[model samples]
Target: MRLGIIIGSVRDGRFGEGVAQWFIPLAQESAAAAGDEVSIEVIDLKDFDLPVLTSATVPGAANKQYVDERVQRWSAAIDACDGFVFITPEYNHGVPGGFKNAFDSLGSEWAEKPVAFVSYGAEKGIRSVEHWRAIVSNFHMVDVRTQLAFSVFEDVDEQGSVAPTDSHADRARALVGDLISITGRLVTTR
Candidate 1:
C-alpha cells in the first residue's frame, strides 16, 4: 500500500509537520512486520507554488500565480498513491486555506483512495478534521475512522515534537495497520 502523508498546514511554525514526522515511521514499521510493503510519502505544501484558487485560473487556467503547473503535479501524486494520512491542525475551527486550496485543485485523482487523519490542536483537532472528512467525501475518497490527535499545549515538548508516549505510539501504529488492512481489501475487493 502506498500511503501519502499530506502535511495539511503551511504556516511557518505550524505543528502539523512535527506530528507527521513522529507519526509516519511508526505506521510504516507496523505494516512492514505484517509482510506488506507500504510506501510512505510526505506531501508538504511549502514545497509547491500553489496559490489562491480561482475558477478562471483553477481547472484549465494557465495562470501560474493563483494556480500553477505544480498543482497538476500535486494532483498526479495523489493519483499515484493508494491512500492518504492527512496531518492537519485546526486553524480558526477549520483547515488552513492553503491545505484547502491544495485539495481543491485536484479532481478525480482522489477517487477510491482511502484516507485517514492525524489531527492536533488545543482540543485534539477533531473540529478541523470533521470539515476535512466531508471535503474528501466530495472527492469520493474513503475516510478511515481511526485517528491520533494531540494537543498543542500539552502533547508536545519545547522542541515541538510529540512527547514520546507508549500508549499514543501503540494507537498510532494500530491506526496505520488498520488503514492498511481495510484499504487493501477495499482496493482489491472488486
Candidate 2:
C-alpha cells in the first residue's frame, strides 16, 4: 500500500514541512510494525503549483481530464495513493486556501480512500481538521478519527521549528495504524 503524506502548506516558511519531516519516519516505523507493506511518500502541495479552481468543467465531472499538465500530474499522484495523511496548518481558524484549491482540482482520484490528519495552529489546528472532515466527505473518503494535532505555541519554537513530544509520537503511530487498517480493507473492496 502506498501512503501519501501530503504537506498542505505552501507558504515561504511553512511549519507544515517540519511537521511532515518529523512525522514521516514515525509513520514508516509504525507501518512496518503493523506488518503491512506500506510505502510512504511525501506529496508536497508546493510541488504541484496548482492554481485556484478555474476549470470550466466541475472537478467531480472532469473524469480526471484536466486541461493543464500540472493538474494532470497531480491527479496521477493522488490516484496512485491508497491512503493519505494530510499535514495541514490552520490559517485564521480554517484550512489553508492553497491546499483546498489543490484538493478541488481533482475528483475521483480521492474517492473511497482513507485519510488521516496531522495539523498545527492555534488549538492544535483542530478547526482545520474539522473543516477537512466535511470537505472530504464529498468524495466519500474515510476520514480516520485518530489524528495528531500540534499547537503553534506549545509544539513550535521561535525559529519555526517543530519539537514534538513522545506523546505526539504515540498519537502518530495510532493514526498510522488506523489508516493502514482501514486502507487495507478499502483496497480489497476497490
Q: For candidate 1, write residues 87-186 as lDDT tens digits.
A: 8888899987888888877676777788989899988889998999998888578888888889888888886677846788988987887788877887
Compute the lDDT of residue 100 as modeled in candidate 1: 86
- Which portions of model 2 miss their true places by more than 4 Å? 157-160
Distance from true position, residue 141, model 2, in Å? Answer: 0.3
For this target, which candidate reaches the highest TM-score against the unseen true structure?
Answer: 2
Candidate 1: what lDDT?
0.79
lDDT of 2 by residue, 51-109 (tens): 78998999999999999999999999999999999999998888999999999899999
Show the lowest summed lDDT stretch of 10 residues, model 1: 58-67
Candidate 2 weakest lDDT stretch, 10 residues: 151-160
Candidate 1 displacement at residue 71 in angstroms:
0.9
What C-alpha lDDT do the candidate models reach, one value each? 0.79, 0.92
